[model samples]
Target chain A: MTGIRRDFQKILLALLLGALLPASAWSKTVIGVMMPGNSAYFQEIHQAFLTTLTAKSSAGTTFEIIVQKPFPDPVALSNAARKLLAADPDLLVTYGTSATLAVLHEKSHAPVIYGGVYDQFTAQLAGPRATGCGFKIPLTSLLRHLRELKKVETLNVLYCSLEEDSVRQLNELSELAKEQQLTLNRINLKNREDLKKAPLAKGDAIFLTGSSVVAAMLDEILALAKNHQQPSVGIFPDRDEAGITIALYHDPLAQGRKIAEIAAQVLSGRAPGDIKPEALRNTELMFNLKEAKNIGVKIPFQLVAEASKVIK
Target chain B: MTTTPIANSRIICRVIVLLLLLLAVPPLAFAQTRELVIGIEPEHNIFTQMEEYGQLVKYITEKSGIPIRLTIMSRYGEVLQRFKAMHLDGAFLNSYTATLAIDELGMAPIASPVSLAGESVTRGIIFTRRDSNIRRIAEMRGKSIAFVDPATTEGYLFPLALLKKNGITDIKTFFSHHFFTGSHASAISAVLDGRADLGVAKELVYQRQVAKDPSIAAELVILEESPPTPETTLCLKQDLPADLKRKLIDIMLEMDQSREGMAVLKTLGLRGFTRADKADFNIVRQMAKEAGLPGRTSKRQ
Candidate 1:
């Protein structure tokens, strides 16, 4: 009889233990922000986002932000995202198309906040769980500025055919042009020498997207622009020093901070899908005044006032 | 006991109905708050213009939590159309457009552009193809000339006015052909391309072109320069939030010293922002009034 009583007591203790556990453990929200491996801009953006998260979080509800460098291939980005998902993060933060796509592949149950993406609808990146900021680099503004600088009918963009990032931009700009009844004349140069030999015609403007392949030929490209009397504009901020007339770009650090805020909102129990993806709230338009004079194009006062930086 | 049970059932029903009502009303009230959209035309040539927006966006958003979506329009006319449609929450308009936006569209100027000299002004210049024999404003008659956007101060307003004031009333009669190239850079390029005999543009833009392509630079000569016009400015929507306005002004005033904030400011090309009141635009208002221009009405292209 006593043995039976002991078993009953043990069963009741076990039942009580099970009942005492929380209805569900309050989760540690995990935020994964994927970025490029070799960029100070990306680093600064990541650090700023993390700093904001640290400053904002309160006691009891802890959050973790994972900054992953996706290098070599897009698949690497996917793999990193999957690895992050294994931890069951409450939310995901991503930047640019490459990293954003990688996270999308996982089809994360946790809400995903995206940042640094340019034109979500055009890029087809507005996923079910994805909502954050978009890259608001002024494509129309850049083109219009180019028009004001000079009436170059054909804009020749030097792009690496293999790079998905450049290809994505090439496609976006292509679509953007269609809406405005404009044309982007493309010159696919496989090597530096080929870029030099790309056919130059009347009414041509050379536009360089930030590609290492193109960056390798910076001086040569500048020389080509000068020789043809064609204005060259790049999309990278750091490349302004290399002689591109203007660069409509933004700080990746600010981008990261923006995405982090979205992530924080998700972690704080706001629905990710409910949180609309934000476009880059801040952007800087940089112009090399020396390069402008070199290209023989005069800038308007309206444009000069709009520039974030004027490098003379 | 029967009365007690009936009363209890009624009370329970009331409690249940009240719970549903509470759940429905709070969310509906929250949804009623609308988003204010601000349109920005990215004038990337100058940092101050870009920085002003950054400071303003941060200030306004921080204060009101309202998201500002920048609808980048290409030409000056596009902005006017949007303003006419009452689509803009606010806009950063140039003096020419500011005049039009104010006089015609009811846009109130809140700020204006300034230079290192602390003078809020810029000018337009007419440049001729170096090979063209037209060397002076009088000689420009019967020559092909290109003007940038009609709303452009340097590109259109001041340049055209210079011709009108100089007794060359009809550009078409004076110039063999007149064209609107839509921007100062294009105006200069028309001459470089040999498509136009003369071009009207902003002086600094001309300087930038010369710096970029000396060959093109060699092909142009400054034929005339116009008097200065007020810098472009932030003109608010008719009903901008008072708290948001205060926040934007505060942020603009404080932007220079804020470490993280300055980077965004530096992106938009300004040294630093200072406070300006409605009276600051008295010069522009008086100038427009003197020009026989309505507050915001634009001279058609």
Candidate 2:
């Protein structure tokens, strides 16, 4: 009788273990995402990430996403990063260079996947627990496009000198201009009120950099440039929708998909450091014909034809 | 008769539990195994085609409550073979293959892509480099011509039939040489590189290419445009349940109006999808017959 009782107890224990094993194996993966703000660009990247993650999830595996509210400033970003790290998520996904830097600063063990960063090298995003994709519009391509639109003998670039990424981009543009034998005029925006005081000369086209201050003050700058009849080019492709004559940038949707693929690799047991961070390869060109006409620039048929999107 | 009342109650309880357990098992098993397999013709590389159609498959899965598995067949014939084996639950087929599937495999035409202009038809174009001395189809008596693929309707059949109708029959002897370049882009490249004096492609692709490189306009000239052909079709297996078929057609037809659906359509280079039937592809059948392609109706007629 005691032997039979022992056998029954063993069977019961085995059944309980079997039930718990599946529950543990099927538990959904938790991904915590930190975003800079709810800007349209960030939202697009977020949407692409969700769409791709859903599409790539395996049959039995599922995902649970925890998103931190948009951090408006550097302090807010740092606080959010600390709080998110406290949650002990399986992985962390961040957007923009500042937010990514904040997460890296936390020094969490969770793997970090980032997107929409301008320069990953300068951001120092490569580490044992982090990998990301960057978007950098090559200056040579932008200048070549500008040269095709009009004979740009002299180009003026307006940037906020405080931003390191902006300064780097300015230096790159200046070097590229030297190679092309075109004169580049550097204009510094010390503050918001400098837009009205900046020297705008006729026959000098404007080059917009990837600067937050410049983005915040784009409307006034564009109005000033238009008033001066200076055809302007921007780094963000969607800037064309806001009246920039020519905008060149990497495809954000593709970038999001790339980040998701890397995340999938990490989730499937690959170390994050094993995956090398990549820059976006596919570039999209946008042209605003109406802006071209307003600026008294004739966009060549070839440039107009090659554009991925055109705003009239 | 001699059993106690408590023993009878226990027996009744055990019988009821057994019945409940039997009732739950079949549904769990069915849910675990249910999946919809969709086959697509490889117009582009498999990865790209999958990426483009990813959202469409997801949308279908969400609406139909069925998991969708996509299979990209490397060739047109492989898709037909898989359908005959009953391995595919549905397929996205070109007009010719859709017509064949409807006639031979009992497939039902559920939906087809429509252009942004609200047109459900596409045209084939024959083009040559502007510097090429060949002016017309008749002038290409001894020049090499490039075609996308023999199985491609607009890229091969329509354009070839147009040439034959213009009295350039006996292609082997009429043209010095002809070759299949495997894709419309390749055919265009072949012509531009001067390997072939003329090439044929779909009008929409040509226009998109020109839009991306206006230099094509300065270099290549459209020599002829074929008559309009019906667009590609999304087909369903006839054996699918009536309610499920209705749900799928409704989801596809309403795809473009929603944000997620619009993204899928844009990726697939389509404006939207519209409900379709077998009658819409009669023109494709006629074109196939004219082109002398081998299929059920072509063989029968």
Candidate 3:
């Protein structure tokens, strides 16, 4: 009986140490977020994410968000990632595909969560310990608007080859176009300069997705769209200010909040895979009627009634 | 250091340069072209038949000032699936399909077909053998009833509405046996074959039969006709661009007076499209909801 009691005591001590050691060892954790440095909006998203995280966690839970700027810089991103791993974050939240790849190559036990990314399967960004909103912009809404406008058939879209976001969205849109039996013509813009000269096809409307390259060239893009007498749509709401016809946009603020919620789940010891990835918290369909009519497109009142916002 | 040209010659040269500029910039640049794709079921070859019926394609283009193209889908299920896949911009859809579109696909009806009488609604009629004893919907209890495919707007949806209105649910309690015939044509065939004691169809379907065989009408009397509901209409895919979608709606509502458009209208059995609010289809959607057939579910058509 004494031998049995001694064995049980040893087992209990071992278990206590096993749980305590890992908990105590965790400190000064760094959370890496990959984002575009060129845009202030992404900064706002990062700020909201951190604020929400700090607000929710127990006081004195120390963590830092390390944002790696302007993705697709493999070497610099790799170095930054290594530094982050050395700091040893409890988890990593990747902003987009470019950022995700950089973090993925580095060997780290930290769980990964991809934020503000699209085409989860094709991108292969749903890495181990990966769970985040796939953040797909509403394609159905755009198609529906086109149908309502009596312009149902073909579309012309411009993409930046260097921008992963544009490539990702183009692939998804092309797939949808094939299913709907509409033709999608791709116009690749190599740089901001190339964007200005890209020919606008007759009988085609312009569709673009969220890419810093696209965003920076918004003035030129809008001019091209207007010059072609084509209605244009962007994937991000911010693009609306830059003069796209409208944006079928996903709210980054909501996306940030969602990421915070998922991060909390991971911090609470939930298995990342067990936490099924969530879609964006909300998506809105917006239109610019002023822009529409300028391009000779008539706006339907019924569609306006359902819009989150319409710039008339 | 440059010498001035003669005034008349310079003026001519300037005029030529201006003409070249005008020619270089195509007039099409001034025309706004908004394009979207609408998916339609192959029923009656409505999408392809648009050219023959109303020059629907040309009519919409002239009315909306935006060219429209119709893609004929093989089945209603394909329509919903494409909508989900974000493939279609809009669709010409039935009330049943629209119900699913609104709930699941985020689409809303902008316009629906109007009958020759200018009535924008249709009804479902539950019928039985005129010589048989089933006189009312309740008499349908303990009798085998035939339904069209569970997704059909009329044969399944409207009959279900009539059943619910009469406080006769628990389908098993009312009918000893039930089966779906896949379409209105199939359900009518089932009734004619004596395979089922009761069946459901559109009210207009019964009238059409009366023209071909008056005795057929005498053979089956309407057990119940559901309240009038909206006819099939145009639906925008949930995420279509708003301004552009609006233009499409405008095109549809104003298609009546155009000569080429009128022919398309006649074939679809309508004058032209009418403006619709979400409230217009509330009755059908509400009834569907009450009958516990809400959304794109297995029990719903």
Candidate 4:
């Protein structure tokens, strides 16, 4: 009888405290962000998104952001999604295609904001209640730029089997390479250990797909490339000085700004379904002339002139 | 033997023939056999410079029927010295070095490469970030500065002259720190990234960077711009055969007229070459004079 009376008294005391406190004391908007990894591209997007979101915030509205940087894999990404869902966040933000899908698979009610995914519609990652910005870059022009730097024979493609978007990019390049009459050597990097299996060789170039796995192993892959004197091109511009001989990709700044716009609309009580998704086509083309020189290749002037940035 | 006037005449005739043959052989051989060795000044990228000059040299050799070889100087200031040390027949030089080479080495300006925009002249610019609070020369006092190579007019001499004209002498004390960034692009980068408070670079390079990255346009402002100066000019040795120099000038000036020539010009990121006279370098000479650069060093060029 005393234990039951004590439990009833505790519940009454919590109800009284809740009634006395302001709603904002416990009703802060919580946003959870799922990142595939700490890739420079994602970090740039995330920073810009936060800055814009903070600036656009209303007078009294507050945000509580929970960021989860999970190792780029299916299981970890799903676990990250479940953890975020458990928070009952008002919105879920995702960077990279893998994380976006993992979050979508959980059937959450919160609006989803996705960024840094390559070809969102083509990869079938887009869905209802998901309004955000994704990017599309021309792989043909990337190959053309690579060819301008050197005569590519057996183009080595570095991709991860786990990343759906990465696999989509690789498959796209493979089809294009066939049309161009160029041979391809696809090296699948499933995890960290697979980085050592890449056969970095001479007289050919490496094409790095937008896979988190490849990005995680970029340093070692580029080192092997440099050690073997094989030039490389990539879809991601890592810090603008990844020793990537050629890079052509959408600007992270543009993607981030667009994402923040969509997110602000959602925060303003608009339906995610009402806000139409947009695609970013503005791309940045860079040539690492220094790396080219290190590998004993001279980028022609005509092509150099075309690059948006040349690291001389 | 008996001394005779006829025998003496025959000996004199033979001597005259031998002397005439000796004189004729050397002139003919020098005119035909000697290959022209040209020097390329150090630029932002050696490989780029080499590829550009290499394609031009190959084209010129094929067209002019004269063997031409290219050599790159170790640095920007060695053009005139290497002209003597390496027996350089001519060189493609920026306005600063071209002016110095003309005044000191007696080199003649043959032609200048027109930019892809068809501009044969470039200007010097002093720039800084809008937020850097370095709007004027007075504001640059005690601040860091990035200057391009001393061998470039737009990079170094023009800025130096402007500062002296503003009465800010003794740069060592005027600025807390100053160093050469070696390229106009580097100087612009230093200013944009806040590595330096002020930067002096070629206006062409600055514009090129702005075109590449639009954010640079928002971040930086041009504080000053010098009068137009000659772009890279082909300055040939004074002793080169007049015909050879004319042939080179004609080939470059007429490059855009033919398909093959246009292809080569495209490779070098140029529209074509235009005639450049010593008078075209007057702007550079005046800038150098204002900066008090002549005879500043024993190896001035």
Candidate 5:
């Protein structure tokens, strides 16, 4: 009877240890990150996420960060997402609207954290396991700065016709312009050549939307803006120097940290759905004084003083 | 006994929560230690160049409480690339690079170095050996010329536009050979060494070199000079926090007021830094357009 009781106790202890071992013994967490491109902004998000996760993991959870090669288009992004999903990562992090959509399309049960997206709601990325930061350039703020920069009777906007985010931003701007009683000229850019051929009237300020095509053709567009002497405003903070008179955009590092915080919450056993998608809280205004002068617009000293950076 | 088990379970839960809190705190604290990175284009021996700006870097860091790192890019193109990559938080850029950063990177100029003469404008000078007979711009046709990188506003674009205005429209046809020596000093050295009959460089650089070595003035004669344009600017990436930006600008603009700050400015060959306005670089953009060169050039040559 004594021998039997001792054997029974040993079996019960083994069962308890087996139940606890999976939680305590599992040392590594695998995270797969998909980025639209290997641009500096995306890299900042990636680095911040890894640094935050590694430093925060209290369980000494080692992480294997698998970064998919950057994809240029939606199709490439979808394909890369499929490959990353096949590896069965513990979590998925994506940068940009297109990349996040690609991961969502895969229907992977893994939690998805995204950053660098302009409008997550319009992108329709709010799935049960998806939540991250979105940078929606406040039109009111942009228009206010425009008013300060120039007395605008007409506001010209250039966007890529095919990009949903670009169109959405254009529509939003149109509504805002209507409320302000400002005339908005919407120019649809189909290709790089379209930017060069676009007719920009004098005394019209151009507004740049969050369009990949427009971002790619920024150089030509700025050159065109210079030639036409058109004062332009852009949503991309990074391209402030690219000839846009003003750029209102989010801080990439801050955005990265926000996404990392969400990732940490998910790692702490909170479902992604428990976290609401956050809009960019930190908006930076950059003034290109040189571009302003080239376009023949006078910036008020107050506006210049308010700028986060002034490129003179 | 049942109540005791429930209490023990609650204690276990509290311990677990405490452990989670402990783990999360350090990383969050570490993330707050932001780094301010500055990119300086490699114009000379990088070590010496860094040493020159070391005091300024220290002063900025001390004032802002943010650690600063200065990255010297190997070429002008690299400097633009780093800025575009958003790898740099701030930069000391030439007028052309500063203009491009404004247009392409949305970088804002905070301040610019003021010369001892109280002028922040620098002009381009086309020079040749005093003994050379290439007196007129047209006379140098089919002769070799050396210019600092094509990205330079004063050293290349402005002077190149001047050449074009003087009826040298086609460089290939007008000059037998042309190359970029990569730096103003190198371009002047090329002309002095007879490696190239004509060289273009910033007048400020030439003057500084002549001041250090008077023989350079005797050997090189100015063939033509371009109009005064904005000097090198200290720029910051637009995405930085507004408070940090203001602090940085204040520290830089007021650097001359303090002895330590003046010492740092002296090392950088400047009297002090003055607030830069956008109109300062209008001539640079105009010259770029007039030169028929793209406002932003990827190639250094």
Candidate 6:
């Protein structure tokens, strides 16, 4: 705790030094973006944010963006937040719930815009200088659809304890399992070693929670699941790329454009408190028909017909 | 008891008469022995649609005291073909097929399913992606369009009528390319993913897709929406008993009032059924007329 406090003090002094720059040095607006994990989803969002921010800006306006990608652990998250604060950007852009909280934990006066968090309502991720977009996917719907793909007596949930969104999903799945008359096998994958140490996966199916840690190890998990001959689902934009049987997730491009909208407003001298924080409820459900075929499972025709996208 | 010769002869005559009656009026005999078969074409998926139709058939049979059966048609385009070979008392037909049936076979629409939005009618939509440069019908020239099946009123008729009204009589000359998506959701998906520059589909389906994936709203923009026209309606053969049709319509329209009726509706994914009349399908008729669609004679011809 003392070490973190000392780091915070150093970051504050650096921010003070940044504030002392000349007017010419402040001609171009600098925005610091800190992402917990360098996941493809985050990268897509960051790219969209940049594209939209550029498109929505004035004819000649350009931003000097400083980005930090850290491994999403507690210490790394704090360190990433401190590094971004040292830059003392005009606004702080964060992806994911933990990254947002890390910036908030710093107690920085810099305005913050967050995106890609799940169920911001439950987390109350509101602050005086922070406003952005998040999403709420129906975890129960994911479970229901997964069961339709295969008769699930036992469901294996792969989540990371370090990610707040994944933990919330884990808890939600636990409740849903009771309602659906299903037994849950919770797998907390904090690191790569934890995944290696996981017991033999014998569940009827596997569910991939929206954790970067878990997403990073998706190929290994999917391989093991296929070896067990179990169908798998995910709560991200896996899009059949990693052989996830089903994916129900928010549209990252939508969230990216929305976050850019908020960030642009903050840069244009609008208070974050004035802009209302929004939670995007638009979720896309996709079925990877080829993946199901590989796992020797069949997705119901109704589910296939109802999906927004089907990869065959 | 001893049987008299007169009684024995009377029994023989009665048996011969019964056999002759069955042979002479085979249609009436079949009607007496068989349930009313109502054929349905796929709205999205045939399996789910059949299940919903099954619940509806069971409900109507119980309430109207008319034994009803449902038949899943091979394709939406095979309505008149199926009715010709099969003894169908009625069918749950979409606007285009119902209009064609009304013209060719004298089928009258009695009731239409109320969508989950509480509306018994739906509209046609012309849409394209938000990032696409095609907004006006003129801009769609030399660009591909994704259309639902030709048998669908909202999918094909609406756009056809719209183009004709704009003086583009020949689609082959105007459009660079076009294809049918076989389903409304697929048609919308085509435009959303940039597979097609423009798409025409049922407005209710577009709304449902947007509800499921709201990002669709963020990505696509509607260029035009047609006036509300009847959705799928329960059209019965004109030769059916008038009292039976009345009873079925009454039972269907009252489905939202009773718990048992509501349960059937829950399975059907519908709020309720609403009474429909010939005037409700004027827009479809107008579109067909504008599109210059030829009405084919019944296969019985």
Q: Pick the candidate with the highest TM-score.
A: 6
Q: Which should have the higher DockQ, number 3 or number 6?
A: 6
Tell me each candidate's TM-score. Answer: 0.44, 0.47, 0.50, 0.51, 0.45, 0.61
Listed per model, the TM-scores of chain A against the true chain A are 0.70, 0.80, 0.79, 0.89, 0.80, 0.90
Summarize candidate 5's per-residue lDDT along A186-233 as a digit string, tens digits: 888867678666777733778988666677677888887777777788
Local accuracy of candidate 2 as per-residue lDDT tens digits, B266-286 = 877788988988888777777
Per-residue lDDT of model 6, residues A1-312, tens digit only: 999999999999989988996553558888999887787788878899999999998765658899999988889999999999998888999998999899989967999999988888777777788899887776656765776677889888889998998999999888777766888888899888988887646588888888888988889999998888888888788843888998887789988999999988998889998889987654577888888999999998756765768888
Worst-scoring 10-residue span by lDDT in model 5 chain A = A300-309
Docking class of 6: incorrect
Q: Rank the models by DockQ, top first.
A: 6, 1, 4, 3, 2, 5
The sequence of per-residue lDDT tens digits that candidate 3 reaches over residues B1-301 is 5556687788899999999997675433322354657776533323334554336666677666766677776555567788767557777776777767766666767888777888888888788766456786666777877786566567777777667777977787778778775455445545643446788876765665565445466557776777777776788765555666676677677668766667778765677778765666677676677677744442322
lDDT of 4 by residue, B89-159 (tens): 88889888888888788889999978998799988999876755678889988787889888889889998
Candidate ranking under TM-score, highest first, comes to 6, 4, 3, 2, 5, 1
lDDT tens digits by residue: candidate 5, B74-123: 76756677866766788888888888887777778888889999998889
TM-score of 2: 0.47
Query: What digit string (tens of lDDT, one per residue) describes model 6 on residues B89-195?
Result: 88998898887788777888899989887889999999986756677888988787888888889899999988999999998889877888777877786665444
Evaluated on CA atoms against the true complex, candidate 2 attains a DockQ of 0.01
Collision count for each candidate, in order: 57, 0, 29, 0, 21, 0
For residues A1-312, what per-residue lDDT tens digits would candidate 1 score against the true structure? 999999999999988997886533455666666764444455556678778877777755556667676562556767888888887777777656667777888765877776656556556766567787765444555675687788766678887664455676787679766765666777765576787568755437888764545655678878878888888776667543878887777666767777778777777678776776655423456777887787788777666654668988
The true-structure Cα RMSD of candidate 3 reads: 23.7
| Model 5 accuracy (lDDT, Cα) | 0.77
TM-score of chain B of each: 0.73, 0.83, 0.74, 0.85, 0.85, 0.83
Clashing residue pairs in candidate 2 (N, C-alpha, C atoms within 3 angstroms)? none
Residue B160 lDDT in candidate 4: 91
Error of 4 at A109 (Å): 1.1
Distance from true position, residue A278, model 3, in Å?
Answer: 1.9
Interface RMSD of each: 13.4, 13.6, 19.4, 11.4, 22.2, 8.2
Question: On a 0 to 100 scale, what is the lDDT of residue A53 in model 3?
Answer: 85
State the C-alpha lDDT per candidate: 0.65, 0.75, 0.68, 0.81, 0.77, 0.82
lDDT of 2 by residue, A145-168 (tens): 676677788888987675545677
Higher-scoring candidate on TM-score, 2 or 3: 3
